[model samples]
Target: MLKLFYTPHTSALATRIVLEEVGAKYEITLIDFEKNEQCSPEYLKINPRGRVPSLVTDSGVLTETPALLVYLAQLFPQSRLAPIDDPYLFAEVQSFNSFICSNLHVAHSHRMRGHRWADEPAAIEAMKRKVPQTVKVAFEQVERHLLRGPWVLGEQYTVSDAYLFTMAQWMEADGVDPSSFPKVLDHRNRMSLRPAVRSALRQELGDQ
Candidate 1:
C-alpha cells in the first residue's frame, strides 16, 4: 500500500489524481498548512523539505509532483497514464512536467511564496505584482506550443494533463483569466470531467 502526504489546493492534488488514475491501493495523510503541521518534527522526518505530496512506497519515499506522477504511471503501466514503452515519448512527458514545475508552478508560487526568492519587502512585493504577467506569458507558451491539443501530449491523456490541470486551477488566483487561453481552458474542462479527477477533487475540496 502506498501512503501519500498532501495538502488540498496545492500541487499535491496532481499526485492524488494520478493515484486515482492508476487505481492504486493507497492512503492519504493530510499535512495541514494552517496548523504548521508540515513543519512538525514528525512530518519533517517524512519529507525534510516540509512540502506536500510526499509518497511513501515500500521501496522508499518520493517527493516532487513530476516524480510522483511518473512513479505512479510507471508503477501501473496498464493504466496507460504515460508512454512508458517509448523512450522518446516518455521523455516528452517528462519535459512537459518539468516545464510546469520549473516555470508555471514557480510563477504561481510568487503570488504568496515570494519569500522563497527574496527577503526584502520591496523585492517580494515586486514578485507578487509580476505574477499575473509572468504566469500569463508562461501559459501563452503552453497554450500555443506545449499544450498539443485534446490532451497535453496529443491524443493521450497522460500525467502531464493532470499536472497542467492542477496549475490551471490557480489561474484565477494568479489574476490571469483562464478563458484567454482557449486550448488550456478546454483541456482543464475535460480534465475536470475525468472520474479520477472528480474523485480527487471531492476528496480534497469536499461538497463545495
Candidate 2:
C-alpha cells in the first residue's frame, strides 16, 4: 500500500485529491504542523525538507506534490488524470503543473510561511503584502491560458487541473478577487463540483 504524509489545506491536499480521482489505495499520515510533528526525527527521515507531502511507494519515496500527481496519474492511466495518448498534451499539463506548484505556491507561502525566507517582522510583512499582487498576476496569466474553460487543458480533467484548482482556492485568502478572472473562476467552480474534490476537501477539512 502507498503511504502519504499529508496535512490539510497544504499542497498535500493536491495529492489527496488526485489519489481520490485515481481511486488509489493509499494511507495518509497527518503531520501535525501545530505540534511540530513534521520536524520530528522520524518524519524528517522520510522527507528531509520536512514538507507535509511525502509519498512512500514500494519503489521509492516521492516528495513534491506535482511529481506525485503525475506519478499517480500515470500509475492509473484509466483515470485519464493526465494525457498519455499525446506528448504535446502531456507536456502542456506538466507545464501548468510546474507553474502552479513552483511559482504560485511559493507566492502564497510568502503570506503563511514567510519565516522560511525572512526573520525580520518588516520583511515578513512585505512578503505578506506581495501576496495579493503576485497572486492576481499569476491568476490573470492562468485565465489567459484557459483553452476553452471547464478545465486547465480544456475539456479533459487532468491531475494538473486538480493542482490548478487547489492553488486557485487560495486567491481569496491572498486578497485577490476571483471574479477578476472569469475563466479561472469558472474552472474552479467546475472543479468544486467534482466528487473527487468534494471528498478530498471533506476529509481534509473534517466537519468544518
Candidate 3:
C-alpha cells in the first residue's frame, strides 16, 4: 500500500485528489503543518524539507507536488493523468505544472511568510503589495489559457487541473477575484463536482 503524509487545506489535498482519481489505494497520515509538525525530526526524515504530501511508494519516497503527481501518473498510465505518447502535450502539462509551482505557489508562500521576510513595516507592506501583484499576473495567465474547460488540459482531467483547482480555492479564500477568470472559476466548479474530489475534501475536513 502507498502511504501519503499530508495536511488539510494544503497542496496535499491536491495529491489526495489525484490518488483518488487514479483509484490508487493509499493511506493518509495527517501532518499539522501549522503546528510545525512538518519541521519535526521524524517527518523531516521522511521528507528532508519537512513538507507535507510526501508519498512512500515501493520505489522510494517521493517529495514535491508536481514530481509526485508526475510519478503517480507514470505509475498508473491507464489513469491518463498525463500524456505518455504526445511529447508536446506532455511538455504543455509540465509547463502549466511549473507555472503553478513557481509562479502561483511561490507568490502565495511569500505572502504567507511575509513576517519572516522583514521586520520593517515598509518591507512588510511592500511584500503585501508585490506578492499579490505577482499572483495576479500568474492567475491572469491561467485565466487566459484555461479555455472552455472542465480541466486545464482540456477534455481529460490531469494532475495539472487538480493543482490549479486547489490553488484557485486558495485564491478565493485570499479574496482574489475569480470573476475575472471565468474559465478558472468554471474549472473549480467542475472539479468540485467530481465525486472523488468531494470525497477528498470531506476527508480533509474530517467528515468521515
User: TM-score: which candidate is best?
Assistant: 1
- The residue-level lDDT of candidate 3 at 32 comes to 80
- Which whole-number lDDT from 0 to 100 does residue 135 have in model 2? 79
TM-score (C-alpha, index-matched) for candidate 2: 0.95
What local distance difference test score does each model get?
Answer: 0.93, 0.86, 0.83
- Model 1 alpha-carbon miss at residue 207, Å: 10
Q: What tens-digit string does per-residue lDDT give for candidate 2 at 87-149?
A: 998888888888887778988889999999999999999999999998787777788864356
Candidate 1 per-residue lDDT over residues 22-81, each given as its tens digit: 889999888888899999999999999999889999999999999999998999999999
TM-score on alpha carbons, each prediction: 0.97, 0.95, 0.91
1-208: candidate 3 lDDT, tens digit per residue: 9999988877888889999999999998888866899889999899997877899999889998998888888999999999968999888888888888888887876666676668988887777777657777888888876443767777877889889988888775554788878888888888899988998998888922
> Against the hidden true structure, what lDDT does model 1 obtain?
0.93
* Candidate 1 wrongly placed segments (more than 4 Å): none
The residue-level lDDT of candidate 1 at 159 comes to: 94
Models ranked on TM-score: 1, 2, 3
Error of 2 at 122 (Å): 1.1
Error of 3 at 115 (Å): 5.4
True-structure lDDT of candidate 3:
0.83
